[model samples]
Target: MALSRYDGCGETKLDCVSPGGVCFDPRFVGGDGVTFYFHGRKDQDFCLVSDTNLHINAHFIGKRNPNLKRDFTWVQSLGIMFDNHKILVGAQKTSKWNDNVDHVVMSFDNTTISLPPNEGSKWNSLVMPSVTVTRTSNTNGVMVEVANNFKVIATVVPITAEDSRVHNYNITDEDCFAHLEIGFKFYNLTDIVDGVLGQTYRRDYVSKTKVNVPMPVMGGQQRFSTSSIFATDCSASRFGLNTNRRDGVAEYPILHCSSGMKGSGVVCKK
Candidate 1:
């Protein structure tokens, strides 16, 4: 979502305008589908997707602009932490956007998936489950999703604007950048879940973490990077479990905790 300022009277004040006199600010603008606008060069992390089963953080690359007296930022990479696996997917540096080449790289649990840039490339495992890389209909973006589920996990779309060029800001290179949009939907998720971003489908849920980190750098070089480290402390609440029996009697199985209990296993509770 685009960031905007409110006056003392609680009215939004116009910040920047495009060459066509269009007021431009960080905002989530649209009806059916919306685009989030973010300013860059903050050494902070934004948790775009946070659920009991999934945690995705968007690291924005930001640089300062003395002429504009503001920081211009773009999403550099996404840090996805799910189950017991951690993956990082990001675009390589480029001077302009290319529709043919896939500059994205995905690292699964410290092992990089070495595959040529093509459609229908898939990655699967017990820890991270299934991930498929495919080209968008317009061939201008990349769509990463869960295999056979038809649910999009993440996306990279090209940024188009006359003022969006690298020369307009204090970036280290003259390459253009793209925006990152993510939607996290895990399989077999229960209602009672806890996360930093809260439940994905809950209307009243709000993100508990901050999206922007304000770190002033001279040029437009990335200030910080995310590691492969991740944690899966998620546990479904037992209160949501069905324990009522027709005969008015219920039984609960004793849980056996072992060193490897953190891994996948089915628990039988009667």
Candidate 2:
């Protein structure tokens, strides 16, 4: 690794290029330090990561551009299934942008999670003590932790007029295209973990994305699409189904929730 010049602190900042981050039009930085794009279909679910005990799926929302072959998509929300429990987090929809108003929504096991609008304040699941959600800011930022499993830092944001103009997103006054910008830190991913980002963590994994391009778009939209936000039925899915037990019975449960942020804001389950 090369050292940064005194004023050139390129490595100090966090961007979509972080190996464990997902942001903006759904760009992903895999564990191998390679960046790629996966523009899944609008209003569909795609698996982001999958392992023996953890499965993460993202629901996409987007619009079509006349000139572009694909829909300009963003991860509208996330569904996480772990240790027989479920977590959901995402940005709420708004006709206009307002930082003063909270846009982040969260839920655990079908119950809404509401953290006070104060930085560092936190809420832990009563029945599931290993899980906790903390606010990183007064609004729009949060960190979810599952003890030894993983930690996720996420922020709610909207695509601005400038962003739409530059990228031709066609974002209209009816919606500001609010979505999530999230980062992951894994404490226990197996070598065989599989997904767009998960496969890069494998010990023997090799990147298939070309190195010459500035934006390397990953292929295989079909390989990662799930039936729904909480369905772990993607082709590459490895959540819980592979586990073996004394009775040889695997309990794979899926928790479904209504999309969109609503109802008295987010309130954590007591």
Candidate 3:
């Protein structure tokens, strides 16, 4: 079969010098939006485009002279079949870890549910001794296993309980600055999120606060200004609130991160 007219670049042409990454932002099911990203290098150009057939392809530009290496080379192409149900389901669960892993979590309500292990470990050996399993207080959960070489990898504890070294400092509040040290271990699960899961992090900082600012109610001219309020003070800072808080029913201490790593131990003083 011959190639369709919509297979290649139509009227509008794009160029890339050296592209680092490319992504398509398909907002909805029927959304026809497409974006092309370009990252340029010295003489070579890397370009990526989502064509009308929902095929995303990457191309690289070579030398300018009339040689075989001068022509654009097709690197890779990703065909996104939105209309196919099986393909859509598989695409939706590209990086899901819970599909085949088995993890057991014991709850206070006498519920034992198997969850998916985070790091994709196959047939994990979770050894809980009779003495330790019976006492189940705030004790450290231990897991011991014998290696093939018979070397004991014993005494494993949580990384947060170990000693941490601080690197830099950050500002916490208007009059307070925080010294950040690496203490806790936080997993960076910064992956591509969708819909509800994506908006959860963005709306976390939304809280109830009373703003006592004056403004025109019906577009009428109204001069309102606080003597203490300055033009520079009106500027908003796009950082995090570095502090500490209690977590869950257990009231575990959770460090507030604003502008540093999640595991960074930020200490604020008056």
Candidate 4:
């Protein structure tokens, strides 16, 4: 079979360097999308993509052994924040890989949604606003689209012999150390837009920052923790007087009588 072409870089392994001590050396496959490679120690957070409105954060998982000469990393969770809303999709760890199941869970706005490890499963939410997630073609990754304009793609592949030999990673368990490839594509993005990696179309964007690190896996069907991405403003609520009240007397007593927490006894008259 003929070798595939990736981003016109041929079949070579493109080194992807980012902050937070992570590196991705991925083979280029022909596509208009930009791919990110992450290889590093476990329990570390890498800011994959960050812009004015969107932020993509990845969390890696694996055993942290200082005595071992070789370490492996796997993608445990992907956190995406669009505007003020955020969503997190993670893979559940299992004692062993199951051919018949795909254990995945998603959390948004303090709500958890789970889907059986089956192909073609999808999740849509209006409450979260303007994002849809679908399982990957191979049921190992996820494709996320926001407002039908921006796309985020994530996939996992086993480290090739070339990669292991080139990086000198001791292969203990083939499944333990997998390569995570993330790609980003925006529709009609203007040249002036700046992000964490700078303008998405710039030719020298990926090579601007470089970091070399030697690394980092997930199992079980447990749900990962969720966090709010929006900043909160502490503001006091002002209750307005109802014009339909009979006698024109303010019914402020009803507000205090409501169950749960107690409110101030003072009431403003209209």
Which prediction has the highest lDDT against the true structure? Answer: 2
lDDT of each: 0.39, 0.76, 0.16, 0.41
What lDDT score is found at residue 98 in candidate 2? 91
lDDT of 3 by residue, 68-102 (tens): 22221111111111111000000111122232322
lDDT of 4 by residue, 1-270 (tens): 011123442212212221111224321111112222334446655444444444555566655446664245666666766655777766665543443454455677657865445545677886755667766643565666676345555554455556557755544443434435554544423223332222323333433212121110111112111122222110210112122212211111222111111211111121
lDDT of 1 by residue, 151-189 (tens): 333345455555556346433336555545443323333
| Full ranking by TM-score | 2, 4, 1, 3
Residue ranges of candidate 3 with Cα displaced over 4 Å: 1-186, 195-198, 202-270
Q: Count clashes in each candidate, considering only residues at least 3 apart in sequence or on different chains.
A: 9, 5, 7, 14
Residue 47 local lDDT, model 2: 92
For every candidate, C-alpha RMSD to the true structure in Å: 16.3, 11.0, 27.1, 20.1
Give candidate 2's TM-score.
0.84
In angstroms, how far off is 220's CA in candidate 4?
Answer: 33
Question: What is the TM-score (0 to 1) of candidate 1?
Answer: 0.50
Segments in model 4 whose C-alpha atoms lie over 4 Å from true places: 1-40, 62-71, 116-118, 137-139, 156-180, 188-270
Candidate that beats the other on lDDT, 2 or 3, i.e. the better one: 2
